[model samples]
Target: MPDSKLRLPPEAVKKQHSLVWRIILYFALSSITLSVIVGMVLATWNYHRQTEAFQSRLDYIEAGYTESLGSSLWFYDETQIHTQVKGIMNLEDISYVRVTDNLNLDIETGTRPHHQDIKTIELVYKNKPLGNLQVAFDRQAVLTEASQTAIMMIIAQLASLLLLTSLLVFVVHRLITSRIRDMALEVNERIDSNSSEALSIPESAVHDEIDILIHAFNTLSEKMNNELKQKTRAQQQLKQVNSELEDRVEERTQSLQTTIDELNHALKALNKTQGKLIEAEKLSALGGMVAGISHEINTPLGLCITIHSYIDDHYQQLKSGFDSGQITKQDFSDFVAIMDESLGIMDKNLQRAAHLIKSFKQVSEDQTGEHIRDFSVKDYLNEILETLSPKFKKTRHQVHIDCSEHMRMSTYPGAISQVMTNLLMNSLIHGFENKEQGNINILIAEEKGNAVIRYSDDGKGLNEEAKQKIFDPFYTTKRGQGGTGLGMHLVYNIVNQRLQGDITIEKDCGCEGACFRLIIPKKLDVSDS
Candidate 1:
């Protein structure tokens, strides 16, 4: 399409008169018209003014001549009249002076120039009119002076008009016409496809509408160029993206398949490991119960053995006294008393050992078995504490179970027992490392159909690293000192995998020890195991 800027061709521009020339012509005509009007008005006014001045001069001459001429006419002196006329004729701007007698005789002096304005006054003596004095004024001298003035004025006005028109033409050509020509050339160049670079124009500090137009066109050019570049880049990018997308989709599909295979293998391994974990969990818990029970049983059994040894010695002394015939009634009485005391001590210690064994047996049975039964949560917590009592008895650490006795759960009691055992042991071993006096609190409550257990201790809280890996298998702070690390891991597994519950280490726990929050379902799904 042809650009609007090039709508007017060079030949057309030349054919069309430039605005500057037209304006100059119009200005010249207007100036000439105004000058002519002003010149005519000034000439008319000058004519009238000169006429008045001339009239005054004529009146003065008439007045002066009246006295002399009246005297001349009254005495009938024609020579004096002639002399006076000649005198009037010698005055400036006076072309001809004429004198006429009452007899109708006329006399004149000086030559008549081109035109004349004549005035007549009668000579009167003693109130009687004498011959009339006709004074004629020559307009030729005034016309000559006025003609000189008009010539000068025309010259000056013409010069000024010429200079102004020239300046106007020069300025208009440079500022407007030339710039328009440049715009046309630029548009023509742009229409040529080979010169399709973006248009650029030099800008002036001060600008007019044409400059604004140029700026707008430049902006459009820049925008089109940029859009074209962007279009090319976008097309390339789209192609690249399409190619890459196909490759990525293929790679990702292969990767996903591999990941699925790896995941299946991992899941199988995890299942196998889970079975071993269950067994290990059971053996570990049973071992702890056995150790605690044995510890407790040792004391009572030792006492019983001591009592038996004493009773046997006393019996031997009695037998010896009887054989040697050196025994007394007091010795027999002492022997009977010792025997009674020994029997009573033996019975009490045996009963104590049996009780310890029974408690261990019950705890072991519950922890190793995943049997679901209705059990009081509070009472279960107490039982686990009792079974683990030997571990804490030597320390000044206090463990409090804060749970409503009425709070019961129809879930796996074994899981509950094992979880509590692990948490207590974790606190004792990891939390209260060397501290004798510590406090452990277990708060159990029901919330939204789940038993919320908050267990914390007043011992050194877990560090950042420990908190992060606390539930990871074989990750223990006290690895060599029989930490085992499985306590918390086993607890996590039981609570999450078996008990169908969730547990979180609450960092904001208002205690100086690690706090574990366990949310166990009141009713567990036994099939999950």
Candidate 2:
């Protein structure tokens, strides 16, 4: 499917323009723009130079012919003046010249054009003004010469530009563009034929980008071809398996009825066994709670008993001294002191015993019954931990709880207690199995009207497989050990079904131990209950 998508469409290939033509068009436009600019600058410079040369000719005529013409005019020689005027006209760009004496005699040569520049010079000989000489320059003729030169220069530039552009186009097309077109055509052909043939590298003196592209394309083609071959083999194997399955189906039809009966019987037995195991797990949890509470209450009760004995013995001594009339003020004072100290000790131990019993009773009822009620999250968690203190007190493991004292929830405390019990047990049995000491932290907060409980342990963290199947029933890492594997499974059921909540393991928590997050509604709906 992916390979078919990778094949280029025919319309796309047809619509693609030739790379060589695009390059040529761009190169030609740039060349023409540059040539036009340079030609304008050169033509302007040539025009200015021609104008300067014309000015130089006028200067020469003023210096060389002015004195001679002035002498001829002073001598009143008309022929000599005419010859000088004619000679001046023969100079470049001088179309007309005239010389006149003071007596109004004039000699002139050449015809003046309409567009001409006239220069007037004084004719002087021996410090005497003879006449005024006027020279006319043809502005049109000078302009014409500059125009001709500019035209020739532009023509040569254009010719060179055309030749250079043609050469570049030819070389670029031959070296790069032609090879690319060939590769495209070959690729299109292979796509049409559904062939997996690798592209052929073109002949080149040096390896370049084009060669690299060919190598990469060939590698991709070979990989795709291998994949196609594997797919073909897989399809053939699937057909063979289908044929064999048909034969097996016919043979299995003979015992189909027997298998159905046996399966039904086995399913019933399995259900019965599962029910018993679940019941046993619950009983086991309750039994452990009882043992823990009993062990906790023993210390306070024993202390109270010893204190009671000491108080009674002291009272007897006081009574004996008073009855014999041998009790003095010091003895009475000592007796009062003994009585006060003993009573205080006894009262403290009795209070301790009462508190332990109260915690045990509350946790026990919550674990046994499915009653929903309002309770403080912090207080209830402490009570649950108190009941499980025996399991923790035997080891150096510590449990810490972080929750607001005022935070409350209206849900099944029994389900919550059971979930917590199973989690702590998992941490003890699996997470901190071989560790001498570990820390268990429980953080409770409210988010969006839901009680968010984050529980983590500072023990060996769970592996990938354990994290994946940790909630699956009968999926225990310790198969032969005293691991029921139903502890976490029961926790999953209680949180999801009983409490109508979600529980998930935090995989990327960066903790050295396992971490689990539970989110349950602070108040369960009637329907949920």
Give per-residue CA lDDT, model 1, range 1-529, as digits (tens): 1224655666646743456678788899999988777776666677777788888888889778888888888888878888888888777777777776778667777665443355678878888887777666667667667666776777789899889888888787777776766776677777755454544568777889878888888878788888888999999999999999999999999999999999999999988887786578668777877888789789989999899888889999999999999999999999999988888989999997886777677777877665778888777777777778788887888998888979889887877877887777777777888887899998888899998989899888988998899888878888687666667788888788888889999999878788989999987766665
Span of ten consecutive residues with least summed lDDT in model 2? 1-10
Give the Å shift of residue 441 in candidate 1.
1.5
TM-score quality measure for candidate 1: 0.48
Task: Estimate the TM-score of every prediction.
Answer: 0.48, 0.53
Model 2: per-residue Cα lDDT over 47-118, one tens digit each: 677678768987898899998987887677778877777788788777888787778787767775553467
Most accurate candidate by lDDT: 2
lDDT of each: 0.80, 0.83
